[model samples]
Target: MKEKKSMIEEEKEDHLKSTKRIEMEEQLANPDEEPQEVISEKEEY
Candidate 1:
């Protein structure tokens, strides 16, 4: 039972890591676009 719990925890950690990696990649891919998005949000306000 402990082994199964550990495996589930590891899977959750891996999923979180993967999502962080994806967000990092997106930021890297659109380093300029992010500023534009922020600017648009400010303009809306």
Candidate 2:
């Protein structure tokens, strides 16, 4: 049971890393179309 739990944890970590990597790659592949000012305005002042 402990071994299975460890495996599950590792898998979850791997999935998270993979997702973040993909997101970063996509961002790099395509330049952001939105302006920084617009983004800042939408966020907290």
Candidate 3:
């Protein structure tokens, strides 16, 4: 049972990991452009 559980856990995915890597690449490609997340956060203030 533990072996099966471990296999299932290993299969689980972390979507944010891929998103962050893509974000970093985009930043490197266009350092001048601001990310929308930062803009939205600033608007919250």
Candidate 4:
């Protein structure tokens, strides 16, 4: 049971890291778009 739980946690962390990496790649691909997106997101808050 402990081993299974640890495996699940590891998978979650890996998934989050991968998602962040993808976002970074997209931002890099379109440097101009990212700033506008960020500004709008901040305005929402």
Candidate 5:
């Protein structure tokens, strides 16, 4: 049925969004201790 298919798609989308949120939270919780090295470059017009 069309309704059943739509429900399954919605569930899949919700699961994907949740997983991405969890990954982001984990990264925020444990940040890198080392300072990031940057290479300064002259801006070109």
Candidate 6:
């Protein structure tokens, strides 16, 4: 049970990292746009 819980935790961390990477790529693609993703995430939380 402990191992399964830990796996879930690790997966959550990986998802956050991947989401951040995707946002960064989006910023790169739209260099002229402001970094609004960060602000949006804060609002979501």
Please give, for residues 1-45, the per-residue lDDT of candidate 5 as tens digits.
999999999999999898677656655664652112111121232
Residue-level lDDT of model 6, residues 1-45, one tens digit each, is 999999999999999999889778878887876568555866899
What candidate 3 gets wrong by more than 4 Å, as runs, is 1-13, 37-45
Every model's TM-score: 0.66, 0.67, 0.48, 0.69, 0.64, 0.68
**Which candidate, 1 or 2, would have the higher lDDT against the true structure?**
1
lDDT of 5 at 27: 51
Segments in model 6 whose C-alpha atoms lie over 4 Å from true places: 35-45
* lDDT, residue 2, candidate 2: 100
Q: Evaluated with lDDT, which candidate comes out highest?
A: 6
Q: Model 3 TM-score?
A: 0.48
Candidate 3 residue lDDT tens string, 1-45: 999988777666455567677778777776886667644665899
Error of 5 at 12 (Å): 0.4
* lDDT-superior candidate, 1 or 4: 4
For residues 1-45, write the lDDT of model 1, one tens digit per residue. Answer: 999999999999999999678667766887876745654775899
Off by over 4 Å in 2: 33-45
Error of 6 at 43 (Å): 14
Residue 14's lDDT in candidate 6:
100
For all candidates in order, the CA lDDT equals 0.79, 0.71, 0.70, 0.82, 0.61, 0.83
